[model samples]
Target: MKLYPIESGNFKLDGGAMFGVVPKPLWQRTNPADANNMIDIAARCLLIEDGDRLILIDTGMGNKQSEKFFGYYYLWGDHSIDKSLAAHGFHRDDITDVFMTHLHFDHCGGSVQWNKNRTGYEPAFKNAHFWSNADHWKWATEPNRRERASFLKENILPMEESGQLKFTGLPENHILENSALGFDIFFADGHTDKQMIPMIHYKGKTICFMADLLPTVGHLPMPFVMGYDTRPLLTLDEKELFLNKAADQELFLFLEHDAHNEIITVKHTEKGVRLKDTFTTQEIFN
Candidate 1:
């Protein structure tokens, strides 16, 4: 199997919101904020080419949103799914499965796009089956007040409406082994209800897609949960358990939201699990 790190786009978000109650004095050291208190974030999606299937994990924030809507996030950079795919000599049509870690606009927004006529929305990848679990599908569709803003209908409903939406089986335990997408899925709930973190076995190593569960290296600390998380306490437990295991097993974490650090590994230190090292896709994959 071959893997590619797809650069969907880059944007800036309030560092305070990203690091939750963690004071700026601490998080700013790792994720330094700009003058406006905004920190750089990347919608780094992953593409896996295995045999007949080309599966894409997460399709960053698409370009369909209005300028006013996007202005809030401070979009930056020229990277787009099209350009990134072309870099790997592929296109949207080549994706057979679009497995989303969650339904947040920044995670799955690129799955749907405005149709040619501009009359309505359509599946962005005409040939791909959009993947989400039943629990998350309901959570996002019937979002609570706190998360309603992040789960936009324009970025979601079109996949189901187009008859291309598929659901992955929720595991009874935290880890679902041998999923339909050909990888183990680590189901996490602290960030959102039933957020699926893909544990991909590739190139003789396990690359865990660290979605919002661990947004950036700055979030490695136990209490450094995002304010957006509905259950911050639960996030602490999940992160502790996951990071401990990651350190013990020497797993490579494929960060989706870290603009600068692409892949990382953790080690057991006196202060608990901490960042051991970071690597670009070229260093790890090639």
Candidate 2:
């Protein structure tokens, strides 16, 4: 199996919203913000080439939104899925599965795109089966007021409309066994209902995709949780348990939202789980 870091693009998000109650002085040290207090954010996606299946985890926010709509996020960078795929000698048609961690715009917005005539939306990956659990699908489709803005219909509805949307077993099941993809998904509810974090066993290493569970090295501390999380206390407990186990097992964490640090590992310190090391995908995987 081979894994590639597909950087779709970069954008800026309010540091305060990203860090929650963590003081600006503390988070700024790791993810320094701009003059307007917005920090750099990356729509980093993962591509898995396992045998006949090419699985894509999280399609970063696509370029279909209007300028006014994207103005809020302060989009930046030239890296795109097409360019990244071409670098790997692959194309969007090669994708057999689109495993979404959640349905947030920044995470799964690229799943659908405007058609040729701009008449309506269509599945971005024409040959892929979009993977999303029943619970998350419902939660995103019928979003609550707090999360409604993040779950855009243009980013989601087309998956099902295309007749390629598939559920990965029951959301309650801790591990959704996808033997074909060579990964068992671990579900977390704190970030959003039924957020599936893929636990991939590759090349004698277990690579856990840290999709919002641990955004960056700055979020290593137990108290540093995102304000966007619906249940912050649950996130604290989940992070504690997940990090401790990850440290004990010496697992590699593949960060999604961290613009600078690609991958990181945690260690058990007196202050609880802390960043041990950070490396790019090539540095470790290659």
Candidate 3:
């Protein structure tokens, strides 16, 4: 199996909301924000080439939204879905599976694209089976007030409409076996309902996609949970359990939102879960 980081690009998000109760001074050091207090975040997706399947995880925010719609996030950088796919000798249609961690726009927007006529939408991956649990799919389709803005119908509805949407077993199962990503998916509910964090065992090393569970190294502490999480206390429990497990197994955490750090490992220091060491993506794969 081979894994490639498909960096779609970087975008800005409110640092305060991202860092939760953590003070700006602390988070700003790792994820420096702009004048408007919006920190740059990488819409970093992962591509897995396992056996005969080429799977893409969490398509970045696609370029379909209107200028006014994208104005809010301030998307930047030259990296794009097409460019990144080409870098790995793949294309949009090459994807056999679109493994969404969740259905938020930034996470799944790139799964569909604006059609040539610019009149409507179509599946970005023409031949891919998009995967998300049944419960999360339902929750995103009928989004609540807080998440309604994030779960755009245009970015989601097209999957089912295309007849390629499939569920990943039961909602209660945190550990999903035989994932399309070719890893064991550990589910977390705090971030959003049934968000799957892919725990991959490559060679003798374990690499985990820390989705929004731990957005940046700044979020290493349990309490630095995102304000966007539905249940912050549940996040605390999830983080406590997950991090400890990662530490015990020596898993390298691949940060999905951190603008700089690609991967890190943590330890149970006197100050709680502190970063033990850091490494680049190449260091692990090389």
TM-score for each candidate, following the candidate numbering: 0.99, 0.97, 0.97
Give the clash count for model 2.
0
lDDT of 3 at 4: 91
Q: Give lDDT tens digits, candidate 1, residues 130-249.
A: 999999999999999999999999999999999999999999979989999999999999999999999999889999999999999999989999999999999999999999999999
TM-score-best of 2 and 3: 2
Writing each residue's lDDT as its tens digit, candidate 2 over 153-208 gives: 99999999989999877634456676335688878889899898999988888889
| Model 3 C-alpha lDDT per residue in residues 1-286, reported as the tens digit of each score | 9989989889999999998888999888877888999998998888888888998889989999999988999888898999999987898888999999999999999999988898988899999999998889999999999899999999999999999999877534568776645688888999899898988888799889888888999888888888899999999999999999888888899998887899999888888888999988888877
Candidate 3's TM-score reads 0.97
Give residue 42's error in model 2 in angstroms: 0.8
Q: Residue 125 deviation, candidate 1, in Å? A: 0.1
Off by over 4 Å in 3: 171-173
* Candidate 3 lowest-lDDT run of ten: 171-180
Give, for candidate 2, the lowest lDDT window spanning 10 residues: 171-180
Candidate 1: lDDT of 114? Answer: 94
Worst 10 residues of 1 by lDDT: 277-286
Candidate 2 pairs with clashing backbones: none
Which ranges in model 2 have alpha carbons more than 4 Å from their true place? 171-173, 177-180
Candidate order by decreasing lDDT: 1, 2, 3
Clashes of each: 0, 0, 0
- Which pairs of residues collide in model 3? none
